[model samples]
Target: MKIDWAAIGSVIGVSLSVTVGLVALFTLGIAGLSRRERAAAEGNGGGAIAATGAYVCFAACAAAVAYGIYLIMAKS
Candidate 1:
């Protein structure tokens, strides 16, 4: 039996990076939504932009999650 340390390390690094990145993106989406709500209460024009940004962030997070699922399923 042989252990490929480099392959193991790369997989761990990539998985951690993807996990953190998705979490950060989702957090930003939530923050943008909160800002939109605040702007709406303040009667401002910035809510539209914030809403658009929030949607983009949320979509990206969803896509990343779907892709991860596909990768796992593909191996089976």
Candidate 2:
């Protein structure tokens, strides 16, 4: 019974990168919300754009999570 070290390493690398990317995406979403609030407080007109971007980020994150779940439950 031989082990596939390369396959294991590949999986680990992909998993780590995806996890970091997802976290960063979520963080950006949070930052967008903060910016939108600040803009609103200052009576700026950019709040709507920022809010829209923030919602898009959140939707992307949700879609990614849903795709991952689908992959896990998918049959080959």
Candidate 3:
């Protein structure tokens, strides 16, 4: 099978961008957790659910990025 370098590059570029974005989102989630923890300590019930949702989103994005990378690596 002939390899399409342009397609491969595009996939890799997109995957890398996704991975970076997810990592940034994961960082934000962590920050949210820290804020939430402080709020909880200060007697506020906020951020727990949002933090969880953020983590879930980060995981899904990471998985998508990994899948994209896999597609780029796999021969067609």
Clashes of 2: 0
RMSD of each: 0.9, 1.3, 4.5
Instruction: Give all candidates' CA lDDT scores.
Output: 0.93, 0.93, 0.78
Q: What tens digits encode model 2's per-residue C-alpha lDDT throughout 1-76?
A: 9999999999999999999999999998999999999999999989888789899999999999999999988954
Per-residue alpha-carbon lDDT of model 3 for 1-76, expressed as tens digits?
Answer: 8999999999899868876887887777777678778878898888677678667766876787688779879956
Residue clash pairs of candidate 3: none
lDDT (C-alpha) at residue 64 in model 3:
73
TM for candidate 2 is: 0.92
- Candidate 1 regions off by >4 Å? none
Task: Output the lDDT of residue 75, model 2.
Answer: 50
The candidate 2 region of ten consecutive residues with least summed lDDT is 67-76
Model 2 residue 16 CA deviation (Å) reads 0.7
Report the error of model 2 at residue 57, Å: 0.7
